[model samples]
Target: MPKHKEYTILLLSRVTLKAHEFITKVVQSNSAFGPCPEYICKCGNIQSDICETATVAISSVYHQVFKTKTKFSGLEVLGFDKTIITDELLSDLPFRPYNFQLGILRIWIVKIGCSNEITTNLAGPGFKSAFIYQYNKSRALFFQEIDKNHCRVTIYYECNAYIDFIEQNPDLVWSKIGILQKYNRNQLFELTNQYTTNLIQAAQIPYCTLNEWNNKEIITNIYNYHLKCCIIANINWYQFFCNKFEQPNTIIELRSALQLIYPIEHEIGERKFRAWKAMLKNVGCSDITPYEKDQSNVLNNLIRACMHLWTQRISY
Candidate 1:
């Protein structure tokens, strides 16, 4: 193990390592930053304003303190939401038998809002998300719950999705705090599904069927294009089908076509199926009730994974 440092610590995922490393920098700090103007937030319901984030960090083991500036940005990221605040609970947080926490602990004063340049008193529009820095590393984590000074809400769903992405694309990953709100939930899910869809072209995950793909050459050529458009265009699932099938252009047609692949159970699941289609028909599929949540519980795990990835990038 290397010598322990101040504002930072190495977060090791149960590597088969014999020992661990801890390094720290002068802690405590403050700053203001923003999302690039070129980026537009486009959730179906809420078009997020351009977000400007401010972070503050006070480093120490509860009350006894030392570094300040080193903890600045680390503290601010948590403040991005009310769910991530940090106080005493972080320092005294319970640990699993397999996990180890290293830190002087710290406090966060975060301000979150819809514009890098604009200011407002509205919340949920933004928050004071809280975070914790491991004693010898820059990687900071959302303070898990224990007390009010440390109210870390679990958003494991998004985090897990992020991890699945980086694990699949290990060489490089980039994250912006609370930026997930900028995308439509359905869009993000579709993007992930598309990302997975493309993996087939490079090296088909052994044993997985390319189930309904009719044209292999088309799939290979459009991989990168599909990825780029998924981010850049204001497209949705219906548009995707129209572009691909050149079939009919109604929700009925789209639903009917997709059902051919993942067919709706007619006899057994009549009630659920009726509810599912009724929701879309009445409220539009994009306005569907938390499809991401209903789809899988692993969504929470993905959110946690994303947080771990974020801390890894900036912690050093």
Candidate 2:
């Protein structure tokens, strides 16, 4: 049995003093409330126990924070919305299993109106710039304040399952073989390039000229396209290797071949022409065996296909 993963989001908001006061009253009133039965069942939890515990903890923190002082340094007030296990969030996850019997579930714990020391850390000039750089590198979703004092910050925590169902179950071999036969190298590359070009064109506007809505959509598209490209590349590589090794029918044979020549290494300064040269290297050499020569040919072709798609920068 594999351990279940938990995903969490902490949202921070800054509101007017009056608005904050009103929100505090509302949270206090619903201090003992739990998520409804529908949500509990949908989330696949046992009788809403986890949801109720989270709600109680959030309410307790809110009560403690608002009991004495009105002004706090960082995000001090907090509230829990609901534990959602919807298909929307699941579709956004990095991994989408195909033809495998692996169970991949995501439980989203969204905490609204939360406060932490991160706000205070962001106040420093150096930390602010560094944080922005890190945020951009992460490519996570970004939100801004609706008004003057209202802002939302969301943080996600994801856990991945480690069970190797592919090895445990031999019945899924046909499914993997089917995936390999579904797309060839050329077809995969063509589709990936077309999709990437569309995404690049849609985001061609100047960053400074983009409005809030446009910016959000562009960012989301960028992330989604990146994930799509990765998935396509993985499938393409699997198919490439399976074909390169003469289409191994059994899982054991496929696994052995992959273990021997799974990762095609690329040097930092290596040129595309150099890979071509290696592929055309004579098999008479004592250093390179016939098998190694064939591997080089496959590697050269794969690199050429990927480079051709990746270098295309279509402009509007």
Candidate 3:
């Protein structure tokens, strides 16, 4: 393979190994706390905040090692969440793994929410009324993938749903942490494994055939057909739908709709969709609309029609 690819693989391996060691130490050191179920119960109920304990821990380590501020430290980076592992971030690391280039390893920090059933089971029916007992629980998953095919998932960190609960119920901190850690170590492993397996299966499926259409005329026909469906569905044509005209917002909405129709996984489909969008934007069509106005409700009927068409074409 290319030298850069080899270098990336080596760098990521080292980073993963170091990260594991650092997190393990942090968890082990902080795992001991006294118990107090009364204080935990006294906290009442509230929505669970996305626990930043793991993010903070990881960020602290990264900052110390790299001497650079990350998103967790007000770096203002856009990603899925605060604790994401991107290729750009991996490239910043200095270490290189020795003789480890079997395949490319990409690490992703995935946030998995606790199911209502599990939460209800844990807290019991009496505690179920509490908002904290609802869907407040979550776990941070360290998903490592090799060449997008082989994946290894592990629970990197666990946290109580309500941060205040941990604070007020200081004695029960270890118990609370232990609950999630134990559950995640056992039950959640199977859940994440199954989820990862499903993703792998989905990825193995061929890209939708709708993306193969290259003829502009056929594409335009499809667009018009959807427009007609929108009109038939009583969508306000002048107020909502974009036609062959100078409607920038409408064009943007149309592009978004196309994304839902042909997702990013469909590489050729995305290219074709963009090309189609550009064509509609620059080279205005006289055949579709009599006049143009501000775009609104562009998604309503258009989405319905597109989804209908998509469902007919693609099979899971």
Best by lDDT: 3
Candidates' TM-scores? Answer: 0.16, 0.16, 0.16
Q: In candidate 3, what residue range of length 10 has the lowest lDDT sum?
A: 35-44
**Whole-model lDDT for model 2 versus the true structure?**
0.26
Q: Is candidate 1 or candidate 2 better by lDDT?
A: 1
lDDT tens per residue, model 2, 47-164: 2212333334334434454564333322233323323423422422322322211122111212111122232211111110001111223422211111123222232222221111
Better lDDT candidate (2, 3) = 3
Scored by lDDT, model 3 comes in at: 0.29
Per-residue lDDT value at 154 in model 2: 30
Each candidate: what lDDT?
Answer: 0.27, 0.26, 0.29
Candidate 1 lDDT over residue span 1-316, tens digit each: 1133222212211111114211122222224553221111221232222223221112221112322334334223233233433432142222211221223323342432222111111112222333343322334354222122211233233333211112111011113223334443222222123332242232221111122223444433433333332332332323442343343222233244334544256332444344334323222122213354335211112222333443332221
Residue pairs that clash (backbone atoms under 3 angstroms), model 3: 34-171
Backbone clash pairs in model 2 (N, Cα, C under 3 Å; residues 3+ apart or in different chains), count: 1
